[model samples]
Target: MPICVYWGEDDFAIEKAVALLRDRVLDPMWTSFNYTSFPPEQADAAIQGLNQVMTPTFGAGGRLVWLINNTLCQHCPDNVLAELLRTLPIIPENSFLLLTSRNKPDERLKSTKLLKQFATEFREFPLIPPWKTELLVQSVNQAALAADVKLTSKTAQLLAESVGNDTRLLYNEIEKLRLYAEGSNKPLDVATVTQLVRNTTQNSLQLAAAIRTGDTAKALGTLADLINASEPGLRIIATLIGQFRTWLWVKIMIESGERNQQAIASAADIGNPKRIYFLQQEIKFLSVEQLISCLPLLLELEISLKQGASEITILQTKVIELCQICRGS
Candidate 1:
């Protein structure tokens, strides 16, 4: 693949793809002379990488010029885009240009148009939707296999639920599990997952669910678990604020007759449309006014924490207050 494009939202997958390309293209002995990686944010990265990729290899094998997070087809300045369009078509067979982006390229751009000619070499690694549990489990199993660890199907499912769809975090958790099970022949099980994985984000979601349902005790318990686990005070507040804000947005949109799940998910930035069903159920008992009021109160809690108030006290007080408000007391 002379002009390889590995664009994706999943940084881990993008990185693995890039590394594989490097191994396939560049000779290890001549890597210093053959491999160049350009971060698109750097000054003149587009022109520099294009010029570099066209330069022939010094000694033996193929050369690779990687533009990680390249935005040439979308945000590159005019000069750089012009230079890229001029240079891309003439790239040597032995010299490869590898472009990766966090987003899909703008199809209308000339650079994107030219690249479409080589669509077979273009790869995309979008994040798995929230409802794709099977894909997530497969990902974890693959990571474990690479690390020479055995992750059972049931355990992988449990782990995927805890980690959600963050590939970087999933890989990190798999490595941790690998080390944990190094000497034992037994595979990683749900019991070990319960003991080791922090799953702070999921806990925060559970906190939101507890609050939405007016279960003060459960809310307090989840919050306490989070606090005891050394989760940051501001992070907890931020999560609650985000959840409540999402609820408010979805509620208002529903009232406005936005019945499409995809539209609701996109509007609320929810990764999984299926969660909208659960969100609908959770907020069924609460009013729009209640959801609307959450952010300001959470902001106050945040300020109190920053001003040296005990986190436990502020968090517990806010949880109780919200629970009361949610119960219409």
Candidate 2:
């Protein structure tokens, strides 16, 4: 009865842990029969997963019932959660239940408390702060190992800085680097990673920075590159909107006398407290009102894109308008 609870903001880590656990416990040949997965936000996910856990394994390997969102902590009704608490401990000896969430478990929920106590292995994979360069370096190094490639610490640090806190993107870039260096028998160097990795996350940040600094040309160039790369228009708008929301949060928190980075991070639900420092700097030139105004502009852009507007042209026009707004023109 190997019961595990994996939760945190690092979804990539949670996903990998799930796969690793599945490989370790479930027999590949019998996986189709014994392994089950439940995604988040499904109304019956908790009960369905619980039902699967009750079923005995049909073959030699152990059974695995994985619940990805684990809504019991937040959305499940009290009676249903009580039922889960009652049923969870009785899972067959050969069965395993793995519950994962991208958000921290709400301690106020009875189900979370029950699972915390009953789970044999509880692991948390919180987002590493961007300013924690060493953690980022270690993360990249670890990723390289999982990818069966070598990366110099400096190269790893560079890659970490380039990708920010996105584990999935970091891993993807590492794989690309491995492929690029496959024949050369060379450990990835800074120059090689710089040459090969596109760093779309960085590009997004750059676009935001450019817009804020009134660098119209740079903003337009970054927008064109993103558009040409076929990044979805709505996704781009969403990213900007999210950033703006964060900026607004920072502004409000600071105005309310919240100077502590950790406090700001908590308010914004930002994984890394150190990121608050960068957010502080980024939002320095803007106001809460300005950030609020930007949201509607972005929403309008999103609506226009969905209404069959020209994505490139709409994005171009919005970026220019935002730049002017940022410049107070």
Name the candidate that leads on lDDT: 1
How do the residues 1-329 of candidate 2 rate in per-residue lDDT, one tens digit apiece? 56899888888888888888898889888999999988876767878888888988988799999888776666668767777778877888889998887777788877778888788888899887544445677788888898877887787767876776679989889888878778776787777778887763444656777887778898999898777766667767766776777778888999899889988988887777887887888778887777777778888998999999988888999999888778772
Worst 10 residues of 2 by lDDT: 198-207
lDDT of 1 at 191: 88
Q: Which residue ranges in model 1 land beyond 4 Å of their true spot?
A: 127-135, 145-148, 152-154, 182-185, 198-202, 217-329
Residue pairs in collision within model 2: none
For each of the candidates, give the backbone clash count: 0, 0
TM-score, structure 2 vs. true: 0.65
Model 1 Cα lDDT, one tens digit per residue, 1-329: 37887777788888888888899988889999999988857888878988998898988889999887878667666787678678877888889888888988888887787777753488889876444455667777888889887877788878887776678888888888888988988887778887887672455667877888788998999898878867678767866787788888889888888999999988988777887887787688788898877778888998998899998988999999888778782
Please provide TM-scores, in order, for all candidate models, with all chains considered together. Answer: 0.67, 0.65
